[model samples]
Target: MAEESGGHATTLGVRVEAARREAAGVTSYVLTAPDGAELPRWSPGAHVDVHLPSGTVRQYSLCGDPADRRSYRIAVLEQPAGRGGSVEVHRELRPGAAVQIGLPRSNFELVPARRYVFVAGGIGITPVLPMIRQVAASGIEWELVYGARTHGHFAFLGELAAHGDRVRTVPQDTAGVIDLDKLARGAAGAAVFCCGPAPLMDALVDAMAAAGHAGQVHLERFGPVATPVRDAAADDASGPEFVVELTRSGITVPVPRDVSVLDAVRGAGVDIPSSCEMGICGTCETTVLEGEVDHRDDLYTEAERATCGAMLVCVSRACGRKLVLDA
Candidate 1:
């Protein structure tokens, strides 16, 4: 898809050429340019922002092959308790429907590794599917532990069959939950990629640490992660207010405990593009010029956080009294 003339806010017009049921409560949509043209080149873990007819936007991982640019594919799991993104897609989006979408963006990039271990839960399998294909083509040894509520809920079993015994399916109804302890036992040297429900990711992270492979794992979250809530008494005792200096704009904004740096900076008449304001999208990442940041985002790796030069301004707060940002 060609980038339009809307400055950096360009959106591609795509038609839903095909929609198929992948599994129970899950459906895959194939999007292509209205004229049947190749779209943008994207990596394995990339996702596109889908703009619904109702004006509600949501991000869905590209599950199709990265080698094929003629179409962009995404799988949506009907989320009844969600804020209506999935409901709109499952109910109203159909073949021949036109929708606007952003270019592919990736926060969960598959880093080079000698070997890999992938874990997917439910619809979280979307992003991992592409990564497995890439890794297999590269001749790297890899394994996948895929789990769903039941065998009926599993998708992509036919594609995974080519991987042979490297893929393990654990349906909760029959096989019970996945055993992270056993899965992480000998996975120390391989890069581990996981995308799933928050609880599964949390358990895997903790399990990896217990198994002496903490730094070997990477994760992509489907929604906002749970951040620690600072107690009112503790925050007040430590002087909760902080100063945010927008270096490029040459403005000093006082960020009270109740206001986020993103809101405070924007209040000073500076525009910062933000999506998923809860800090999951990595859209509001800002360079840190000074001060300590209490990084609260799950987007950054340990090494990225240790360097401490960039932070997601949406949920990240100041650890010191002042923070200088290249905004």
Candidate 2:
């Protein structure tokens, strides 16, 4: 979704200027500088890591205007059954509360495109909301296929309505699930950006791959995905070492069996920003120049992995002796 230099993720202290309810169980918090100053700049598909008062950290996509440096807005959905981070945010992060936040990191950053197709489900719309605005303002051809539990469950329907016929609202209560095959067929030659529940994201990725359009797809995984428990000892004992050539940094580093590419790259002084090193967060996604990968990340489908256009450097490794990376 983007091209930016990756480095250490920094932390900042900010105050919640306002908190407005966006939808049922959804709250949008506007965070601003504590001393009437401007916040860091961020592009579309960016998100910040919020350290809650209860010591739980959660990442939320920036849904506000990127031009507005005065404040940064993020929407959170109360996931009572899933995790405690959202619950804590909905309860404690009210207006006037001071909170610690991470600088915006965007694995889902929006790049220039020919045509754009955005498929968002439920709370997944947060990252796509700003993308739509940016694309629409650029006079680029784009459309959004948004689905929710019900019509009222939508957070920014009012804002979406301004775009007229380009938005397709599919409420699952009355209409069935979005037809993945149809959506993929219609998105030919268009760059597809999808962020949604696991099922929808998984199915659409398969559909896109089956249609031979995997190269133009981008994704943002909002929540955690199931991953096999990583046994570091087992990996250290059996993992194979490989050489990585960082084209951008004009350097090469040896990735030992015990260490990951993320650590190797960072150790070599080329810092690729990462979060949730388990490969579920998609933050360590790096462009692949050559060599097949033993893809260990949950972010890519089986067919998408075959493309090998990118890999999550945190947990994924090389399938050959030498690999070239665009990082």
Candidate 3:
């Protein structure tokens, strides 16, 4: 299969060209467009949304080189409790299989800094690995602190080890435990980018706060954190079905309590652009011209939510009588 160009149309059909096992329970798949042409270009931190057979969609980081236009490489870890996405990708997806994918997009970008410290935990290393490669190629001063339960469970261990002093593998069994305080204390001027489990991220946050380096810390959360449920009294008072107005199409669709605004809009055969239907990625964000949103996504910052102009359609719900969406 050939890769598709970025501009002809909004939807692009792709096919799995090849698949390889990278590590225990981890595999990488190369996908290309159906035209058998070179793939579209993407930046270092870009990722694509893969539509799985179970009708569940998930996001995977593009670990391959950005210059490689022939195909997009994505690594997936077979999560034990995953909602079928990763498991199906590892067990069912094969070369030549047809699938739907979103365009490359990213929110975790590498910014200019004097120095960089990358912390990767378990499979969260997917996105950071590309950044590490880019930084190393540029001869920049950077370090990677990779952590996993054991050496065998760690992905890309050999590749990371080749960097010698530039990489630190902190296997839980060998290193006892990762000490975020000691790791982040002295890195004052360096920018810290971390992607990992919630406990690891929380510890990093605390360590950075204690070291007065909160402003220098940037993080990408691969999964959603558990959020407390709203009080029963705080539920939508009317429990009314509302109308979602699509700005471009000038169409209004009915959104019921059982159906999300995304489903309602999509049912009308409108493509609003979405990936990681769990709301982990900000790909489905749309402008909100009217109505209050019951924000449920973790991707948006408090400030972004307060702007009152955009909302993530996957998990967020409407708080007002109706939502006017600019799809």
Candidate 4:
């Protein structure tokens, strides 16, 4: 199926069946159809865009079992300093409250491997939890290195304990930070999936590279890897406007210096599935039929970027005066 688009008109309405505090400042919401009908099926490492009443949308991982079609579960960590989405989720998402959500989307997909090594930090475990369950049930050799600020900050401890020594719980206050080199060494010759804070993500990539485990490392970043969004002043000083030709839509949109390719096309009534406009999520990725792109997203790998096959319209721009997108 294609990515969810066409704005709220295409959104699915769900009622919050239950809301439980999983950990310190973190809550998990179980959403189901009002009539208790079966919902869509999703795999591990999948997330949904939650549309709040305040018009704010946030992408959250589906941590619940994929086989359970009765409902979808998503966990949210309250961020006091964030851009208000989490705050609204914490305050307004109560049991029986109606909510809208986009269909499940996955970028951090689980590949078939002889063994899997999962690394997570704090709330990063949301996506990895279901993955762990799926692999564990298969009797495959898999392990998890999960860390948080403290033991009390860790969610699903009771569940993780079922895996015994296969799960390594490291509370920074007592265990110190996870050793990247040690982790890389242990995960060599195995498929490694990591999702966490920027520090851990950056260090693990380097460590994995040094240990000659480059192709086996799969990471899902919370935000941009390097390039932050340009400021208004920076945007003003950016290159001239560019034209984007959408082949499928058969429309030509003008992308102004201060505007993104996403805003430009959406302004022209071209709806695209997008959540994090900051270039973190892969929702706005568009095929590039023709164009020199200024790729700015963390979603694509180095090999993928070298091919110039796709571009994240939310933040990436054209390298020249024109671009042809599949849309």
Which digits, one per residue and each the tens of the lDDT, describe model 1 over residues 24-86? 999999999999888989999999888789877788999999988899999999989988889
Q: What is the lDDT of candidate 2?
A: 0.86
In candidate 2, list every pair of residues with a backbone clash: 1-109
Which candidate comes out best when scored by lDDT?
Answer: 1
> How many backbone clashes does every candidate have?
1, 1, 5, 0
Clashing pairs in 3: 1-36, 2-36, 2-37, 3-37, 39-69
Off by over 4 Å in 4: 1-10, 228-240, 246-252, 266-271, 287-289, 302-309, 325-327
RMSD of each: 3.0, 7.0, 3.1, 3.7
Q: Model 1 misses residue 294 by how many Å?
A: 3.3
List runs of model 1 lying over 4 Å from the truth: 1-10, 224-227, 237-239, 242-256, 263-271, 287-292, 306-308, 319-327
Assess candidate 3 and give its TM-score to the true structure. Answer: 0.87
> Model 2 misses residue 250 by how many Å?
28
List model 3 lDDT by residue over 54-107, tens digit each.
Answer: 767788899888878878889999987967788888866799998877778887
Lowest lDDT block of 10, candidate 3? 1-10
Name the top TM-score candidate.
Answer: 4
Task: List ranges where model 2 is wrong by over 4 Å.
Answer: 1-9, 223-277, 282-295, 298-327
Candidate number with the higher TM-score (1 or 3) = 3
Per-residue lDDT for 294 in model 2?
A: 75
